[model samples]
Target: MAGAIAGTAILKNLSPSKGLKTITLTINNDCNLKCPHCYLQYGKESFLVGELTINSIFNSDFEHLAIVGKEPFVNKSSIALLEKMVEKCYLKNKSVSVITNGIGLTNLNPSVANYLDYIDVSFDGGKGTYHLYRKGSFDKIIDSIYNIQSKSNVTFNALHTLSTGTINNIDDMMSVRRFADFKIIMFSPYLNTLHDGKNDVSIVQLEEILKRLSQSTDFVETKESLLLMDIYHTEQEGVSTETLKELMSFYQLDSKIKLIEKDPLNYGIIRVTYDDYVLTPYESIHPKNYTKSPYLASGVNLNQVFETMQNAFS
Candidate 1:
């Protein structure tokens, strides 16, 4: 979640509150594909967040929840958990979204889609370029998108990672917009590589592409996509708690970190790990090898954990 920060201005406005509005639950560490760029720190055994902790989170003040995974739809077990999460969200009057790789999407219960606000399918690239990073599944993912859209009224959006390899086939990737029913095609810079800009799209190149995407009529532009221009302009050697702190210090960002400075009850985005640790999205994604995060037990008061996050980020 905390990878690159371009300038002081960008740091001053890390993200608007809307971007941080959801609490993402990483339900499992199981998946069907082995993408070279996968960010997850895979565990030896399959992991699933317990229902009690999930219910507690739904009962909390967060207005939205996101169900994500190594691939949430990888198996029937994960798909069942997704249905439960969606039911909880509906009962609590909160919106919900699922970010999936579209590996097993068509097999899901059609009724589940009616409760969802969004179904964000991951599209690393398209056709020739996608197979380079994700390997042999571009056609599968594309079919999943088409099938899901035809079966349900759920809003569809595409999440594409712009990397040194994929950027070269920008036209092939953008072609998905012409056929898929994506309301917004979001983009995130590939940040799993070393801090050097070598494996990433340079700021200058990304800027030009962002400009075109912003002005294009292919799909609706989103604030989240526009903010990426700032994220790519800066790069770090690695992702860690210290490296993130240094980036903030170098950018002279103190209370200016408006991203998580608000009351803990309403921090930008909170992440609940597979084992039930409450953490910021940055800590959950980076893990212990890169960052250190407190182990807030599953049943701990949600407010207390939120307070800890406020102190850490604000």
Candidate 2:
């Protein structure tokens, strides 16, 4: 809620020839910290996806690529891989972004910013509760943001998870704008499977919070959050018409914002694992079922995979 939300696009029925807007790759298998809310389970053996696999996707029609890791900058090898990926994206004339924990970023070569379009730092809570959910230095993360902003013109964003805890500490969330210039504050609901039910938030609760915050500063409610609300709309007595009308009114008020009405699986976003399996963004959310579904092999036809994805979700 710190800055104006960008125009939203209602993506649906995209053809394989046009391809996806973005693809997220899990580039590394190691992380410095293990947050309770995160679904990724890091193993002892560290692995970085091969460059061939990376280039294969870059050759496709996707416009952008987003990379994540146990912690992308967790070590020298990981940073090296990230730098290489950024350079590859630059060479391929594709936009690239990364979601980092903001710890190993200090070691990043400032030149990396020349190719990187965005850096979305993950922050679930502010100050007091920052370390409560994830054991990282809160000040260090903020300092890293300040450091990166000074070095380059790359856009910055804060990726947060919404829960009872985050709502209670809403003041801290509001204060993020004071520390750094963030282009957008993106919020996603915490998966019930990942944590205890005490912190679980219902669709009605999420809508109320958005109603309150929407009055102050613009924020982005992710496709996953929207999908959850749709499910709630179908299953429950129904979301209040006034609440829906108020929230939907923002779409008309801001010409830049387009509320995506498509299902999460149809959002033209794919996730590639560290081991090199291509999956739909919806599958990536259910980490427990990551191994249960049949995934497309990264080396195969990516466009064909996209076609399959559209049909399956349609």
Question: In lDDT terms, which candidate is top?
Answer: 2
List the candidates' TM-scores in order.
0.73, 0.77
lDDT values for all models: 0.58, 0.61
RMSD values for the candidates in order, in angstroms, are: 7.7, 5.7
lDDT of 2 at 3: 9
Which residue pairs clash within candidate 2? 7-256, 7-257, 8-257, 8-258
Determine which window of 10 residues in candidate 2 has minimal summed lDDT: 1-10
User: What TM-score would you give candidate 1 relative to the actual structure?
Assistant: 0.73
Candidate 2: tens digits of C-alpha lDDT, residues 98-153: 88878777887877975898787777766777887777888888887788788877
